[model samples]
Target: MSRTVVFIHGLWIHSVAWQPWQELFAGKGYETHAPGWPGDKDTVAETRLHSEGAGVGVDEITDSYAKFIAGLDSPPIVVGHSFGGLIAQKLLDAGLATAAVAISPAPIKGIKILPLSLLRSSFPVLSRPGNRNKVVPLTEKQFAYGFGNALPPAESAELYERIAIPSPGRPLFEASSANFTKNAPTAVDTTRAGRGPLLLLAADEDHTVPAAVVAAAYRLYASSRARTDIIKYDDRGHSAAFDHGWRQLADDSLAWLDRQSL
Candidate 1:
């Protein structure tokens, strides 16, 4: 029997966002399962309706996913994007995944990069005033810098259109802590047992998860025999999953997973 491919989407998206990847993967003799986060709805519209106040914490999302993964008859191979990539790492650490893929996974061991553009992109919602709970949409310029700086106008616009909702400020706030020490007790763990064959897909032009950040996470793998490879894309932006050449990421993932005999 074939192992299941469990997909965990990043912030601002639901399970349906992974449809394209799922369709492509299923065609290659693989089974696919993308589960929703704690407060994520079944569809994009509903996800938008969920609002910022209803957002799930990193642990909530991870633990909820853990329950779903645990019930599986066999450990499913896991894949994630951006924040979802971090979640994927957590799952792998927990020994839940057979193998894992992290596409533009955000900072874990603090990759060194002080790009103001990347920091400002998340500023809209991350550094809010008071306990304001609302989803703040990113401006066109913000979208371009934060997610699609390297992509053309048409591709960037399509991605901006799909920017369903804003992520919760708490995750970002905690993630931006003073060396994660202040938040480590509350944050999700990316260092766990099964840390299976791990693949880190780093987009070369990605503004959010820059080369430095991805490289840093790969370096801190607690696993002894962990296989981590960083695959760079010339024109792909932070919104790589929706980019025109997204097929390459999917194909590379399929090939890597195939190599693991999963």
Candidate 2:
């Protein structure tokens, strides 16, 4: 039987963000699906115009993705980025994913290390209280500082033009207030036996989810009986998966999946 891989994109970008990843995995004989979040548009331009995507929260996003995964013939290998990474972990907790990879995942409840860079990266969303119900778009300057700081200026600018989109602010607010919120949806049951093998990939220079943040998440999953590991790439930024060396990230994930025998 052929294995299936589900690619989950983070905020700002829609399912199209995973096109390259889908093709790469398809070339390796894995069937792939990249599902958009609820209210997601077909393209960045459309999403920017509509902007309702930012109103969706963690619970709604997780529930939507869980329903989609349930319809698959079998559990898929879930791979997610940023907020999608948080959703991947939630799916694994619910016994929906056979194995999982989370790249620069957003903070789940209980992760307390809020680096200065993370605060800066998230400021655009959190700065305005009303943004919880509004779409938040990143300026090129913010994108360059937060997602593409490690890339060359020209490449960073090109990437910003190609993939940047507006994101819902609610999820960021939820993540920021996770620890204080009652029954935060970002909380994961780290002790689930059937959660399966997991890998957390971090970009060493990522302004959003830095090595320290990734390490904290890995530590949370340490209690799991299933194998859990983390890999950090040097000099890469938060947008490593979409940047010039994205293939390396894909290859590393494939190699890790191979080790899991998934």
Candidate 3:
């Protein structure tokens, strides 16, 4: 049978962020889906309005996604970025997905060393602890600086317009100060029998996730029974997935996935 694929978006981004990625995989014959997290609304306008008006926390969002996955009949090849990456790891640890790809995943338990880019990307949230309890939406300028710095102004603006949303402030807080342990909350149990393949794709110029930080996360999951691969995209920037010629990244992933027996 054909395998299923699931896309999990990072902080402040909804499942729609993966439409291009999903469509690419679909052309290659993988059924793909990206579920909306709890309190996450459709469109940039709705999410921005919601954040300014109400609040959604990390636990609430993750729990909502967990239920969504529990209902799926087929185990998917899950891919996630940033906070979504954290959730992807959790699902993999729980044996929910067949294989997983975590891109620029946030810092979790067992993921030590705070990359400066992570800190930079999160400056809007961690500028002060008080900000955590509040809903923080990125101002257009803020989005430009945090996520669009490496890309062209036009490309940055397009991305910002299409997907920028007010994300849970608490997730960033949690990542910042994880009470990390060997079997910590952020730790993924990759050794599960049913777990398939796992790839940790790091971008060398990715000031957002950084090569070293992703390297650490890869090492943590390398202990899995599932074969683990860490591939570095040198000269690729933080906006690697959305930048011009984004197909290169997608193409590379497809090549890697094809070689796997799973």
Candidate 4:
């Protein structure tokens, strides 16, 4: 049977963001799929114009991607970034993936550490309680501070223009309230017996999901019988997946996946 890999993008970006990763994995003889969140458009420009992604919540996004995974011939090696990372973990817990890699994942239920940078980065969405049902677009300054701080100004500006889009506030709200809410979509079933091995990848310079947050998440998963590990990049930021060193990150993940025999 042919092995498959599925890539999931985080908030403010579309499936197109994973195109390079898809091509790289495809070159390695793995069939790759990068599915967008429901109502996402093909291009950032179109998605920005439509802002349809803002209407959906985390549950809706996860359900939509779960359905796509179910149609696959075999459970895939799932890889995701930021919010997508949380979704990948959810899918793995649901037994939809053979193995999973979550890079700079959003805070899941039970992950209590929140760095000041993360709080600042998320303020645009969380500051406005009324934004739960509204679309929130990040300003260039916010994007630079949150995701592009590690990159050169020119490259950061280019990336901001190319990949940034409006994101729904509902998911952030759900994640924030997850600890108090029973069975929140942001909650992970870490103890699920058949769940696949998971890798929590982090970037030390990431303003959003900082190393501290990733370490706390790893501790939460440590109680599970399922295999879990972590990899941290000291020089990278939250946007490491799209930064100049992306190929190195991709190659490292491929090596890790090979060890799992996926």
Candidate 5:
């Protein structure tokens, strides 16, 4: 059987957006799966219409994926975008993944640098405490600024119409206040020396999870002897994973996996 690859999507984006990635990885001789968060609808339109995932938090999302992976014949290589990136790392550390690729992953517990753009990108959920128990949808303008700032305005708008969906606010609140929270859900075991190789990708122009934030996450791995590497792309945003230029990121990921002999 072919080695498996599991793609995890982040907040505000539907799992279906990973179709192109799934096709590409499959062609490369990898079996692929992109599972949605717990309570997510089968389609983007349905998810948008009924925000059943309102109160889901990072712990719940991570656990759901863990359960999914537990049933697999073997541990798969995990790739994740935004919040999914964090989950990928967590899975890798837990020995549930053969390797991990975290693209523009949300900040883990030890990261303290919060860029103005990150705050703005999270405002849709973080501005009000009440939003913690509700699903919050981003306006087209907000999506444009947060996910597609590096793309043409028209392209950004079109992506918003196609793949965007309301996401739970609880994860944002949990990640944002992770440093102070005891047993924070956003925490990652960065110091695991025996964990699989990790590749962290960052878009220099990403408004949501800035490169600085990813750097901080990389720093948290300083104490670990595990192979942790990071790559940064110029003039790209958080949308790099699903945008027109997504192939570049995917190709690089394949190259990195080859280098690691994974």
Candidate 6:
């Protein structure tokens, strides 16, 4: 059977953004699907009109995907971006995926250092405690700084108009307090020795999930006997998953999968 691949998108961007990546993997002889998070509408415009994902938290999103995978023919390779990246890691740790790629994943429990830029990128939601139960939307200016900092102004604006949507604030709040919370939703098994190979991708210019944050996450896996690797993309931002340079990142992931013989 052809190996299956699942694409998971992080906050703000819609799952439809993974269309290109899905097609790319399919052309490579892999079955692919990019399902939206629970409560996500069928399209970007519809999702924006009604924030159905409001109040959804980290664990809920992870469990939703986990359930989806359980029904699949086999545990598929997972490719996730932003918060989706964190989910990818969780799935790999739980032995629900054959291999995984996390691009600019949100910080998990045990990540101590919080970069200034990360704080600023998250401030929109974390600025208000009540946001934990509300859906929050980023302004164009905010999106420009957080997700599209490395793109040209027009390109960034265009992407914002196309895919940006209100996202549940609870995940951001959960990740923010992960370092101090017990049984936090953002927690992941960093030391699982028998998990499948995992790849962490970071973009140097990403203000949302700084490359240093990803580096810190990679260090957390030092105790794992399983394969864990990280790659940094120069002059890219969190949008590297959908930006002009996304193909390079996607191809690199495929290359890593090949190397791992997955």
Best by lDDT: 5
Clashing residue pairs for model 6? none
Compared with the true structure, what per-residue lDDT tens digits does model 6 show for residues 8-126?
99999999899889898989999998889888999999999886887899999999999999889999999999999999999988999999999999998998878899999999999
Candidate 3's residue-wise lDDT over 25-109, tens digit each?
A: 9999988888776666666677777644234554565666667777788777788887777787777767777777777777657
Q: What is the C-alpha RMSD of each candidate to the true structure, in Å?
A: 2.7, 1.2, 2.5, 1.2, 1.1, 1.0
Q: What's model 3's lDDT at 114?
A: 74
Model 6 TM-score is: 0.98
lDDT of 1 by residue, 1-262 (tens): 2368889887655567688999998887778898877666666676666653344467777888899988888888899988788888778777778788999886764445645655776677667643233445556677777877888887787776764455555555546662746545223344443357789888777777776677777666544455666777766778887677778899998888777754
Total clashing pairs for each candidate: 1, 1, 0, 0, 0, 0
lDDT of 4 by residue, 164-210 (tens): 88888899999888989998989898766678889999999999889
| Ranked candidates, highest lDDT first | 5, 6, 2, 4, 3, 1
- Identify the runs in model 5 with alpha carbons over 4 angstroms from their true place: none
lDDT of each residue in 1-262, candidate 5, tens digit only: 2289999999999999999989988898999999999879999999999868989999899999999998888999999999999999889988999899999999999999999999999988888999999999999999999999999999999999999999999999999999999989988888889988999999999999999999999999989999999999999999999999999999999889988865
**By the TM-score metric, which is better: model 3 or model 4?**
4
Provide the TM-score for each candidate, comma-separated. Answer: 0.87, 0.97, 0.89, 0.97, 0.98, 0.98
Single out the weakest 10-residue window by summed lDDT for candidate 5: 1-10
User: So what's the TM-score on candidate 2?
Assistant: 0.97
